[model samples]
Every structure is written in structure tokens, then in C-alpha cells.
Target chain A: MNRVFITGMGVISAIGNSVAENQLGLLHGTCGITKGTRLSTRYSGLLPFGEIAANDEALKEILSVTDPGVTRTTLLALHACKEAIADAGLTGAQLLSPDTAFIGATTVGGMCLMDELYNDANNPANNSAFAPFYDCASVNMYLQKYYRLSGIVNTINTACSSSANAIMYGARLLRNGLANRVIVGGVDSLSRFTINGFNALHILSDEHCAPFDKDRKGLNLGEGAAFLVLEKEADTNGKKVYAALSGYCNSNDAYHPSSLSENGDGPFLAMNGALKMAGLGSTEIDFINAHGTGTENNDEVESRAMIRLFEEPPAFASTKSNTGHTLGASGAIEAVYSVLNLVNQEVYPALHFKEPILATRLTPVQVHTKKQVRHVMSNSFGFGGNCSSLIFSKAG
Target chain B: MFFIHQTSCISPQETFSNVKMDLLHVSVHNKLLAIEPAYTGVAVGVLRRMGKASRIGMGTAMRLIQEGAAPDGLIIGTANGGMEESIRFLKQIIEYHEDMLAPGSFVQSTANAIATQLSMLTKNKGYNITHVHKGLAFENAVIDTAMLLMENPGNTYLLGGVDEIASYNYIIEHTAGWYKKEYTSNQDLYKRNSAGTIAGEGAAMFLVNNKKEQAIAELTALTTLHSTDKELISGQLKAFLKKNVPSGESINLFLTGENGDARDADLVASCESAFGNETTVARFKHMCGEYPTASAFALWLACYLPIDQPLPEHMLKKQGTTNKNRTVLIYNYHKNVQHSFMLVTKFK
Candidate 1:
């Protein structure tokens, strides 16, 4: 059996632009959620968001991408991919090898430029360059084309669980002997398409999101990207191994398109299946990074799910409180956060939680604490009832 | 080994499990609309609210309900997923000035909605994923499902690829010169020798199981290449067929993605030359039109075309196929970028 280990992690969220910065923000309990300024939405003034501080042009400048017409989603992905490969110490030759795979996920591909697409679609004579990037696979395709990566590259769009599935699929690439190394993650930018859609669903929070809270109103929309480099344990000789991705599973609630079953059958099955895959008992999981989207239905259902899985419930927190719900990138971002805990043997607390949901009566870790974090679980549930869970363990 | 126990396709042609010769002509129009089945089972209320892409996918997935236990994993691939709903929702937001917007269209606009709907209908709470890579979408899903089956044997898997053709998407492709400048019929798709190919949409579902007894055709290998060089594609094809194809016993049938575009002639010619004259060549894109997942439709076609079925005059390129059909290969590529290969053998 091939043992997959996480060699590196890179993330850029509302909380921070790099892994270290993000970790510092997590430690200080700093929240990046605020009224949106970057996205061009009419409800931006009312809705809180964990939006990236930089615009597309500035982000491209930071990434040294001079090519015109590149979308913000692609820029965010490239930034994260660069950091991940560099952190993994992957050389240019290694990246060009057929043994390397790149799997990316994104909910807001080029739809971030919905206006451009609409205009271009309405007037074909416009010859809009953004039209080429309107497809959902644009970000991954751009990454693959830019890096000249010819391996088993794929783009996943299972809504929020998109990146978690990407990571899981990347691990399978190594486990199946299809590739020696894989860079897996996802990116999603704040787009009117999603904002209006989520707003229409009445789940966009007007204030800072309070995950796992009884009085939580809704979720703060966010935009970001995160990536992790995974390789076989045997292959990482003297490489900085962060953690072991021991378990991963994706299950669907099949009950609703945007909402989970009241009982969270999807999250339950995903969490249980992940633990089963890791060959660990629920008690062994020291902490959990809950999906807690801060939505009324999500918080309560996730709380009930935790109670059903953990006898006493682990010290869990929804990092979304800090970065809002990053959607497709949340899974990978939280996966990186979970690994940081395993590496440093500490856990961060969920923010803005005044009281627990009455049903589960469960409260998340409310303060930053240090402990011997052995195994951590992260959950990402997306629209279409697509639920995914991943368990990462401490590496020697 | 992964055997396709059951399969269904909602294609432009009347390709629902079995192929129909009717409506099997080249589509002159840019869009080749799918001919859907009147799927029973699953409530009409639930089906009515779903998007076209979701409905097509669910219809295909529902056909495999009686194959066995609930699938351990469900994977779907789509290049342009739920676009009708997406466009509708976006249009509503812009048209209504972002006021009084309904969430129904937004909820159904996601790429994985079909997978979620199927899971809910079947109560199968297992691994579910959706791959949305362009051109390589279906191959990506198949690769994931196949690799998972190798790791977890005996676990039945439902793998599918779905896409839809919308007016705006058609226009987008047309503007990009992805559609023919002059209208060409499906039969004359190969003869058009134009700059663009026709657009089509459909869904293909395969119940992949490890058991050979419950198999229609044993899938030997599925490989994809991300390169534009025809020589590289030809070289890789040779290596792939060498590993999967037996010595001396050449492939009896070749299903090529020869959507009539003079630009792709080099690739089509390269593939034709790679397989010796002994291999009988056939093409599928003309019948179903051209889409990212058209190769999946071609795959469904390859599964049954070798069972002593008379080849259509338009489908055949070279005759003289061996009577003892054993191996069939499906090769397809888009523009010059992504190339995919699938080998299916006659289930003995």
C-alpha cells in the first residue's frame, strides 16, 4: 500500500496571503470578514465577505503574470501553486515530468466576469478576450498550460467540496502509481454570479459569520485559493513532510440541492467513512475543522452530525468564521490549517460564537490553545449536497 | 479489470443502450439536440424541477438502478454543466436588477447537481465527485472511478459524463469558430472540411464492476494525453496499444473522433496510419456531432458495434474487419490539445 504524505501547503485567503501570515492571523483570532469592497455586487455594502484585498490586476502583477485577459481565479490559483511547488522544493524539471499531476477545483472559474460573458454573449462582435476564460475549467487549464504540466491534470467543480476532492483525487494518483507527485487544491473568486446566487438563496450573512452559533444568521461569502503538495511517504526523503492525509471520503445527502438533510446523512457518512479509511476510531481524532458555514441549516446540521459521530465531540472550530466560506477553496485552505495544527501541535478556536445550537448544544473551541494534536479532521460541504471529509495525521 | 455492466446514453441520435439508425445523419445546424428517453421511476415532481443536464444525467443513471446494489461511488464529468440554469439565473439577476431572484435556478446550476439528485434518489451516500475539465472531462471521471475500483475491489461504481447545448454556448463556440462557417449535415460532417465542428450534448453512464460475468465489455485501458503534437500523440498511441493490445492480434475496430475539420486532418490521418490496414476504421462524431464528451458517446458505441453488427456506410472508413472481433479502440482529440484513448475487448 502506498502511504501518501503531505509535503507542502500554500494558501491565500481573506485572513492572509501566505501560509505563515494565515497561521499568524489564525493564532491571533483575527477575522478578515467585512463588507465587500473588491467584488462589484449591489449587495456588497450589506453582505460581509472574506474577500482578498488585492484586485485581479494587482494579483497578476504579484504573480508576475503579464499576459492580458487572465481571470482573477487563475491568478489566485497561480499564486497558490507557486507557493506550494516552491514549498515542496519541486524543481522545474520535476514539474515538467510526466510523473507530476495537477488537480485543481474552482466554483467561480471565469464566471467572476459575468458581465463580460453576458455582454460578449449578447454582442458577438465585441470579440471579448474574457470569453475564452468563461468556462469552469479555465483556471486549471491555465495552470496546466502555464506550467506545461502534461500529467494527469483535472478540474473538479463539486461546489465547496471541490478542492477536498481534488486533494483526495491527487492522493489517489500517487496511490494508484499513476504519478510520483501531485499538486492539488482549488480556487474561487468573488463573483456576481455566485454572490447573486447565494444572496438569492438567502444564505449570505449581513454581518460577520458565526459558525456553530445558535443565533447565526447566514454565511459570509469569501474568495481564495489553497494548494498542497502530496507525494508517497517513501518518496519524500528528507523532505519537509507536514502531515499524512490518511483518510478522505465524499458522500451526498441527496436530500436537497443547496441544503443538507436535517440529519446530515452526507456529512455523517463522509466523516465516518473518512475515519474508517484512516483505520482510526472517532476518539482518536483530537480536533476537527468543522464545515460550519454559519448558515442556519448548516450550523445546526453540522452540530448534530458532530454529536452523532464523536461521543463527546472533539475540540472543533469552523475556520470560516475567520475567512468566511471560501467555497471551493475552503476545503483545501482548512486542510492546510488542520496540517498546521498537526505540525505545531496546537489548535485555533472558532470566532464569533456566543452560544451553541440548541439542538446539539455543542460549542466549538473558543480560544487558541496548544496541545498534542495527533489527528485532525476537516469537513467541506457544498451545494448539490456534495459533502466531503478528510483526516490528516501527524507525521514523524 | 473493470467491466461495464450496464450503460446508457442520451445522445443526438437515438442511442439509448442500443443504437438506432434513424436520425443518424450529419447535423447541418450548429447544435445537435439530444434525444432523451422517457425515463420512468423517480418522481416526476423531483425530475420536473431539475435542469436539462441534471435530467439527462439522472435519466442515464436511473437506467442502471437494477444492475445491483447502490453504487459505492458516483462520478460525473461535464465541460459545460447546467448552463441553461446558470444562464437563466444570471439573466434573471441582470434583467430583474438583482431583485426578487429565485434560488431554484441557482441551486440547480451547479455541475454536481445531477450527482446529488441521483444520490438522493437512490439513497447512496458514498463517494461522489464531478470533473469539469474541458475535453478531458469524461476521461478524468473514468480514470478516477477506474483507479478507485482498483483500490477497492467489488465496489460497484457509477461513472458518467454529461453536457448540454445552449443557445449562448452555441454562439460562444460559433464566435470562436468552433462551429462550421457554412451549415453542414451530419453525414457531410467529414466532407465539410471546414474550420469548425458541430456542437452536441448528451449523457453517458456506465456501471463499472469488477465481476466479469456481469459485464458487457471489459475495459482494458483508458489513457489521455495533453499535447498538441501529432507525432507525440501517434507515439503515445502506439505505446498505449502495445501495452493493452496483444502481440500480432491487432485491433479489429477503430472508432476515431474524426469530426470533419480540415485543421484536424493531420491528427485523423496520423491515427488512421498508426493502425495498419487490417484494422477497420469508423468515426462517431458525425452522428452525435462534436462535444467534449462525444468520445464517451463513442465509447458506448464501441461497446456494441463489434458484435457482428452491420456497419453504417457513413460510419465506416476502411472495410475488411476480422470476423472474430476481439478488440476495439476509441481515440479522440480536440483541436490539437487533449487526446484520449479507450480500449474495450469483446467480453468472452
Candidate 2:
């Protein structure tokens, strides 16, 4: 089998602007979670979020987007894609080749724009003005138009697992000789729709989210985009390989729509499948980026899955406490962090943990520390019981 | 080659359980509406969380891969996924934009919820994919699955397609001339004198494998075209059949994308004329709603036809001798935007 390597990565998260900024934040244990600024809500003062410290106009200028009414989601995605393209040192001409493809995953493609447009009584425009932001075609069409990428461009919206699936597809494309290089990632912006949706479920935390805490409440919402340029190991020209995407799996719980199954069966199966693909065992995983949403249900179920899989649970943390739940972008953002961990040989602590949960007698790593980390696992779970786990290892 | 081991579809037509050639009946009009059963019995917890589309998708997917062990991969296709829920949320946003909106509806609005729900229900976590490319959505997913299976021959994959038009949104969109203004009844679907077909909803699934079996259909070759010309479509089909099938072996069944619109029906007619009366022709869009992955339901219909040999009245366009079902061709389009052709033969 051909080995898939991450040659370049780009990220725009609460931690910092670029990949290096995010890495620095992780190293210093700087939490990006703060009161919401971009999104207006009564919950703003109560609930903390991993919000990018830029308004829509400023973000547009940063991304150099000319369109006036582009969705915040697209703005975030273009920002990350630009950094990724530049980091890979690929020009628009290079990306236009038939051998190059774009696979993007997102839970909401341009719903943010639709939300704003739907309320626009002043614009009173027809479908032509809003046509570019209402459908799935616009998402890829705009990206391809901007980048001039003519090859296969597709979108995956598998909820929170969207980006992980995108990465999995990108790797498979390279491995199967379908494409030589691909850019895969996910993006999502906080919207009134998502905030209220979580509020209706009563899962939004009023205080800072505390994953795996004894008295954990719920998750804080976030928004960001992250992208990775994937290529065959032989195709890369010694661009410092942060990590190898060794193992990945997506699974259906078939248990419930909104809730995970008891005993963490879906996550266990996913982890087992990914490990099997990587030709490794539980012991090989050095650190884990838990999908600890601080929700009573998620942390409990995921912790049980972790304990059942490993003889000794790997030093793990739920970065969601620091970054907030970025929804669809969480998987890709956490994946970037996982690669950084593998490259930097350090593990960030699971902040705000006081005691272990009763159901699963597991305690997450409580403080940031340096370690001889070789392999890292990242987990992203979403509504409709979708669960995905990706394992990345230091490139040999 | 990644072969289709088994397939199943739960649509408006009587093509779900039976596959007898005679049981497959042709519709009298161009658009056929699905007769939905009570889904309360099929899905339990997932049903509560899903809208009409995801429930049908999950039900059909479970039926297709039930006989085999859990699949190592899952790929789903939908043109406008979770739009029913999204529309509902949109309405709420307009009604109560200042209030806290329900996150459940918001989360379910994303198209990927179908795959995610499938994963949570099945606990089969290998590789999950969801594609949304309008008319070519299902074909893109199928191609991806084929590529994945070709790379790793030992693994099994679940490929599924689903699309739904809920009543309120259906009526609202129909007012915009999305569906035929005249064809209101399901019984009058296949009549040739309609501008648009009635909207419908259904789901189909197939368990594709590299290992051959008795009930398998060898998916020999598949191609997609992005053109509207009848001549080009016919040429592509002819070339594909010529390259994939053995010499002198005529296509036994030609599954067409006859959606009752004058322009699209003419395209199907031109292709039928290219093949002549030698092959038995079939059309499924009348039974299933016109959506991106409507061809997915047609493909599932073709896979099951050779097994049970159903002669349902809704499936037949031109009757032929009910000899053992052989090569079946699925040619479908998404409103002239995307064209897909797939050839599948019953494995001896």
C-alpha cells in the first residue's frame, strides 16, 4: 500500500491565525475560548466559545475576497485554503492539473449566508444575487473559480465527521492512483441556527466546558476552518513531514440518532478499524485527542471506549475545552493539533478537570507536558450518531 | 472488479422484495409517486432523530447489507440532503429569529447526518463518505466505492442513495414549476404529455464486494457524461456497451431515465431508437422522485431484477420473452446536467 503523508497544513482557529500560531498556543496551553463576539446572542456573556477574533469585514480583507456578501463559512474556508496552498508551494496553475483534486467536508456549506439573505428585506433581490450561496454547487464552484482548479471538486457533509471523511477520501484517491495530490479539510461558522439548535437540546454550557469532569455540563460552540495538503510519500520533496495519516475509520452506531450507544460500541469499532488499517495495536498510540465535548453523554461513552481499547489509557486531553466545539470543523482542527503533537512530541492537558466520571473510571491528562509522542489519535462525533476516529503517526 | 453482491430498494414502485420479470410493471404516465409504508416498525431511536429522507435511506441501506457482515465502508449520496429539516429550521428562523432555535433541527439540517446516523446505528466504523453533486451525486459515490474496493479487494462497502420531497416544501417548490402542474396523481405518471413529473421520495442500497457470488451482478463498467446532446449521450452509451459486453450479446434490459419532461423523454427515446427493439427497455424515474440520486434507485432495481425476475407492470417499457435475465444497462440524467451509464450482468 502506498503511504499517505501530510506535506502541508493550514488552519484558522481560535488559537491563532496560522498553523504555527496554533502550535504555539498549544505549546503554551493558551486557551482561545472566550465570550462570543462575532455571533450575537443573549448566551454570549454566559457561554464561552473558540471564536476567531475577526469580524466578517476584516476576515474578508484577510482572505482578499472581493465579494461583498460572501458567507462567513466561505470566508473561513478560503482563508485556510490559501494558507494550505501557499504552504504546499503550489500555485493556481499547479492546482489546476488533472492530477490534483479538491475534497471539502462541511456540515453547513453556506447556510450562514442563507440565514442572512433570508432576512434581507432591503436587498429584495432575485435568486441570481443569492444563487451563488444557496446550494452545494456554489461551495466548490467558488473555490475552484478562485483557485482555478479544474480537476475533480466535491463536497462531503457527513455532519461532524465531514472533514475526517474528506481526509480519508483524499488519502484513498492518492493511494488508488486516482490523483497525485489533494487538498482535504472542513469548515463551519457559528450561526443562529446552530446556537439555537444546541440550546433546544439543552446541551450548551453556560460556563467554560470541562471535558471528562465529574460535574461537566455541556459543550461551548466554536467556528473555524482547517485544511491539509496530502500526497504520496514518494511525491513529497522533503517538506518537513509532521505526521503520517496512518489509520482512519468512520462508523455508524445504528443505535440512536442523536445519542451514542452505551459501552461506546461505535467509537470502539472505529478505533479498532483504524488501528487494523494502520497495522498497529492499542499500545502504539502515544496520546489521544479525545472528542470530549464535556457533555455528560459524550465524555462518559468515549471514555469507556478508550479504556476498553487500551491496557493503559494513553495520556489524552479534550482540546474542545480550549477551542470550543467547532462542529464540522472540529475534526479537521483537532486533526491539525494531532499532527502538531506528533511533530512536536508534546501533549496538551485536558483543562478544568477536577475528578473522574463515575460510569467510566478514567482521568484525562490534566496538565500540558512534553513527551516522546510518536502516534496520536483524534476523535470527532456529531449529531445523528456519526463517529469518526483518525490516527496519525510521526513520518519515518 | 468490485461487483454488486446484493441490492434492495424501497420506493413508490413494487420493486422492493420481488424481482420477477413479469412482476415488474410499467407505469402509464411519466411520474409515479411512492406508496410509503408505516416506517414506525423499521427504525427505532434513529427514526426520532431523522426526517423523511434519512429514515428511508437508513431503512434501505440496512436491508441491502443485512445478509453480510458489517461493511468496512459506507458511502451515501443525496442532491439536496436534509432540506426538509433545513426548510423547517428556515421557517422557524423567519417566524422566531430572535428566539433560541432548536439545535436538533439545525444539526439534522446538514446533508451528512444520513451517513452519521447510519454509522451510529450500525456501529460499523470503517470509512464513511457522503457526496452531494446534484444529479451526479450517487454516481460520484459509486465511483468512489469502486475505486476503494479496487484498491483493497478484500473489503466490503455499503453504497446507498436517498432523496425526499416533504409535503409542505414540495407544494411550495411545485408552485415555482418544479413539478408538472398537471400530473397530480401517481396513476398518471408515465403519460407522455407532461411538462414535469410528480415529485416523490425513496431510498436504495447495494452491498458491493470484490468476491464473486451466485447472486452477484458484475458491474463491468461505469461512465458519467456532462452533456445535453442526445447524439453524444447515445454515442457514449454505444461505446460503453461495445467495450464492456461480449460481441453479439445484445443488451437484455435497457433502464432509461424517462422523467416525462419533453426534453428528457426525447433523450431517452433517442437512446431507445439507437438500441432498437432488440432489447427490453425499462424506466424507473416514474416510480421514484426526480432527484440527483434517482439513478441509484434505478441501479438497485436492475440488480434485483435478475434475481427474482419480477415482471411488475410498472417497470416494463417494451416487453420481451421472460428468458433468464442477463445484461442490464442503467442510463439516467439529472435534468440534462449530468448523465450516468452503468452496465451490470448476472454472474453465472
- Model 1 per-residue lDDT tens digits across residues B221-320: 9888888889989899989888987798799888899888788988888878878767888888877778887777887777656567657777888875
**Chain A accuracy as TM-score for every candidate:** 0.99, 0.95
Winning model by lDDT: 1
TM-score of chain B of each: 0.95, 0.88
TM-score of 1: 0.98
For model 1, residues A1-396, the per-residue Cα lDDT tens digits are 768999888999998999999999999999998885666668868788888898877887798898877998899999988999999999999988989999999888998888888888999987688877788888887888899997898999999899999999999999989999999999998888888888888888888999988899899888899999999999988888999999998888878778889988999999999999999999999999999999999888988888888869889999999998888899999999999999889899899999888878898999999998999999999987899999999887
- The deviation in Å at residue A331 for candidate 1 is 0.4
User: lDDT tens string, model 2, B108-160?
Assistant: 77787777667666665566767986677787798789887886788888898
Q: Give the CAPRI rating of model 1.
A: high
Give the worst 10-residue stretch by lDDT in candidate 1 chain B. Answer: B21-30
Residue pair clashes in candidate 1: A254-B120, B26-B185, B26-B186, B26-B187, B27-B186, B28-B184
Worst 10 residues of 2 chain B by lDDT: B21-30
